[model samples]
Target chain A: GAGVSQSPRYKVAKRGQDVALRCDPISGHVSLFWYQQALGQGPEFLTYFQNEAQLDKSGLPSDRFFAERPEGSVSTLKIQRTQQEDSAVYLCASTVGLQETQYFGPGTRLLVL
Target chain B: EDKVVQSPLSLVVHEGDTVTLNCSYEVTNFRSLLWYKQEKKAPTFLFMLTSSGIEKKSGRLSSILDKKELFSILNITATQTGDSAIYLCAVERRTSGTYKYIFGTGTRLKVLA
Candidate 1:
């Protein structure tokens, strides 16, 4: 892909439901990141991956938030038992390598009703 | 705790008017500052500043970082309606051999025609 891409541009889930969002980074990118953005707020770091290795998971907010990059190219972010507070935009980004500028995807807006 | 802050949560300007956005950060091991323009869900890269006092520019958009002050400013000259969007600032920090970005709550710029 020319740029990072994410699946389910929008999602509406009932409280307590689980939702999974997908991201396809640019070809051969070595680093990927996940973030959550609430209304009128900046994107908050969630997790990071260097290749297939999950080097950092410090930012995941809670046990319900999970992310994985099995192949180092595509990643998935899953939220368990979604809550109304979880309504926000989930963004994915990738960089050619560590310390490089990131390219963002067209975030998935999850609305927990 | 690493944190980023942006000023002027929202701005209203007329076309052809100039605007400046501010970003400040307090973090350990700061590496660089980046600016992004987000019109929808996706935020596109604009500029990256690594050296203090050196301005990085592209056409009507320019940004400068001041490490001593721990802040950066993005200036847009002769703005257009198309330039109306959220401007985000992020700081890259390296810690424990891992890297992450801390973003500020972005400035919402509205250029009226």
Candidate 2:
């Protein structure tokens, strides 16, 4: 229960609609990450944040995908004009330091039709 | 580009059997390698290895890293039914003064009673 938590474990959205997935990392975690896992595949990096500053987002597939961690505690991943290819499990992880073990949330499963 | 590769995509074993999972990576600015076990939801951290030749063990699960060879292995002895899940391997790399993970597709294990 003290681990990372994610909202809307499952979401179904029609194509061209927008969707937002939220992640609440463990208390005091300084590093946050977002990843997308396609069916039967390992998670691919999406973005990274330290405290409230987003440091890397090269993994984002396109400009339509956006993520923010305004206060450094919680993060939100938004996808505009969702497409069928966007259906996957979005996972969030956090750690105390760069080299520390990452703690992962349950992940938000999105299905775009 | 950073990449992680896992071998033997799927395995089926019976109780009391021993299994080994392999992960190989090629990345820039390597930081650490991590192992996680995923069931139906979140992936729980199992081990994090930074230095080579040091084996990290917990219960019947153990992992070792070889930075020189750019690979790692996870071994589980006397496997049980509860061990049925996906084992993921991720490599952390420092980029843009931050860090991100490159994950392997994962090895799916099924243990029968």
Candidate 3:
């Protein structure tokens, strides 16, 4: 079985630019999560979705961050007006249910100059 | 705010040696504790502990949780170079009918061959 997968393993953007990171969760997974990991730090939750419904977005740092899962399988995290502080790895994870074991993706590393 | 802490932010151990990583957390409506192993890219799930006093083992790695104390310990016996990575601890809690995960700073283990 394939695990979670992310696209554009690496990305470089200038300040004030917008960037979008994509994630494809495992098939049949009902829960999806996004996290941001800074250098030498563990991942911090960004948002969560359950079958196309955005359940939680409180972890999102600011209003510039937006995420959506339209079809209940693939998700995208979009950051508007990128900032140097946003330079981190964006990780995606999926699980069978709430509080279940989560499988993570390779992550997309974003660099804002 | 919910918080998770890991001891000995970094450690170095020689092959064949045994090591223990600690994780303690404080959160509202605690649900479960999870461990993950991260190398360069993705963080892979190691174990999920929902009960106290029960130990979960796989190969040379084992983990136990102490719910009453709000902590967990992961033990790696006969460590190998392959065990070199960052070990992350996360706690899950329910908030507003949704679950969120709080992660620790992580313990960086460098296993020398």
Candidate 4:
């Protein structure tokens, strides 16, 4: 893909169900980022990965929220025991070279009901 | 914690009108300020400002950074209906080994036809 690509444009999950959001960054991009955007709010940093290594996960709200990029090219964000507060648009972005310009993917909108 | 604040939560303007959006930040070891335009899903990259007094322009959108004031402004001239979107501002900082990015609430702009 020319830009970052995320799977499942929209998701509806029930309480306590686990949901996994996938992201395929641009080819050869070294940096990948995940953000969570709530309704009427800006996107909040969830985690960052530099070539398959999770350098920072401090932004993850709780232990239930986990992310992995085992192969460096693709990533996944998983939320365990879904809660209403976890509903939001999960966005993925990738930057080429250093952390310079980021290209965003059409986010996966998750709604927990 | 890093903080990014955007002013004028929402704005409406007629076509051809000019508008200015403001963003202020407070972060430790601030490395750069970035501006993005989010319409429905992804937030497209707009500009990245690192040094003071450097203005970035593309078409009718122009942005400038003021490191001394810890603020930045995005200006749009001759606005069109297509310009309606949520404009987000973010600040990137160096914390730990990787960079930390924090975003503001964003300003929603509606350009009337």
Candidate 5:
């Protein structure tokens, strides 16, 4: 089975620009999560969705970070006015249900110059 | 604030040697603990533990959780060069109707031949 997949394995953007990272979870996965990972560090939670509903956004660093999962399938993480601080790997994960084992994607590495 | 911490941020071991990585977490509504092995891209799931005193084993890798102490340990016996990677620990907590994960800084293991 295909695990979670993310697009644009690498991205370079100028400061103040907007960037969108895409994620395709496994078929029929009901839970999706986004995380940010800095170099030499573990991933930090960014947001979570159950089906098409955004269940947890508290982990989002700021208002600039937004995510949505429409039709209970694909998801997108959009960062508005990108900053150097946002230069990190954005990871996506999916699970079959609540509290289940999460399968992670390769992640999209974003660099803001 | 919820947090996960790993010990010995980095380690170097020779092949055929055994090593142990530690993870400790503090969070509200504790649920489960997970271990992941990351190479260059995606992190591969190793184990998910929800009970204490029970050990999960796979090949040369094994992990045990201690809920009462809010910590877990991952052991890799007869390590190989392929075992060299960052080992991450995550804790899941349920809030409201959703679940969130808190990850540790990770322990980097470099196995030498």
Candidate 6:
């Protein structure tokens, strides 16, 4: 793909349900990132990966939020026991390296009811 | 704590009006500053500034970073309704052989046509 791709542009989950959001980064990009954005706010850092290596997860709000990129290509973010506060847009971005311009995806909008 | 903040959290400007969005940051080791424009979906890359005092321009948009002042400003001339969106500013840091990026709260621009 010419740009980053995210699946299920919109998702709705119950309070106790778990959901997974997928992201396919740009081809040959070595770095990928995840971010969470609330209504009327900017995207907040969630995690980072450098070719399948989870370099940083400090931005994850809690242990319930898990992200994995085992293949260095596609990645998934899973949220457990969804809460209303968790309703936000999840964005995925890819860059050529640690210090490069990152291309963004359309993002997945999650609504927890 | 590392942080970035945008001023004029929200603004409404008539078409053809020029506006300036401000962003200030405090990072341990700032590598670069980036700006993005958020539409109904994802945020698209606008500009990246690493060296201070060098202005980057694309169409009617331009941005400049001041390392000494730890701030960046984006200028949009002759705005249109299509220019209405959330403007995000992020700061990148290089640490522990890895790269980290953080985002500010963002400034919402509403251009009235």
- Tens-place lDDT digits, model 2, residues B1-113: 67899989999999999999999999999999999999987888999999999999999999999999999999999999999999999998886688888999999999999
Write out the backbone clash pairs for model 2.
none
State the displacement of the C-alpha of residue B21, model 2, in Å, after optimal TM-score superposition: 0.6
Between prediction 2 and prediction 3, which has the larger lDDT?
Answer: 3
Per-residue error for A67 in candidate 2, Å, reads 0.7
Candidate 6: docking tier: high
TM-score of every prediction relative to native: 0.98, 0.97, 0.98, 0.98, 0.99, 0.97
**lDDT by residue for model 5 (B1-113), tens:** 89999998999999999999999999899999999999987888999999999999999999999999999999999999999999999999997778899999899999999
What would the per-residue lDDT of candidate 6 be over residues B1-113, giving only the tens digit for each residue? Answer: 99999998999999999999999999997899999998887889999999999999999999999999999999999999999999999999988987878899889999998
Clashes of 3: 0
Off by over 4 Å in 3: none
Residue A29's lDDT in candidate 2:
97
- Give the 10-residue window scoring lowest on summed lDDT in candidate 4 chain A: A94-103
Candidate 3 docking classification = high
DockQ, all models: 0.94, 0.92, 0.89, 0.89, 0.93, 0.86
Q: B23-111 in candidate 3: lDDT tens per residue?
A: 99999999999999999889889999999999999999999999999999999999999999999999999878799899998999999
Model 5, residue A99: displacement in angstroms? Answer: 1.6
Clashes of each: 0, 0, 0, 0, 0, 0
- Across A1-113, the per-residue lDDT of candidate 4 in tens digits comes to 58899999999999999999999999999999999999999999999999999999988999999999999999999999999999999999998856588889999999999
Clashing pairs in 1: none
Q: Candidate 1 on B24-78: residue-level lDDT in tens?
A: 9998999999999999999899999999999998999999999999999999999
**Cα deviation of A92, candidate 4, in Å:** 0.6
lDDT of 3 by residue, A1-113 (tens): 99999988999999999999999999999999999999999999999999999999988999999999999999999999999999999999999997789999999999999
Better candidate by TM-score, 4 or 6: 4
Ranking by DockQ: 1, 5, 2, 3, 4, 6
What is the lDDT for B107 in model 5? 99
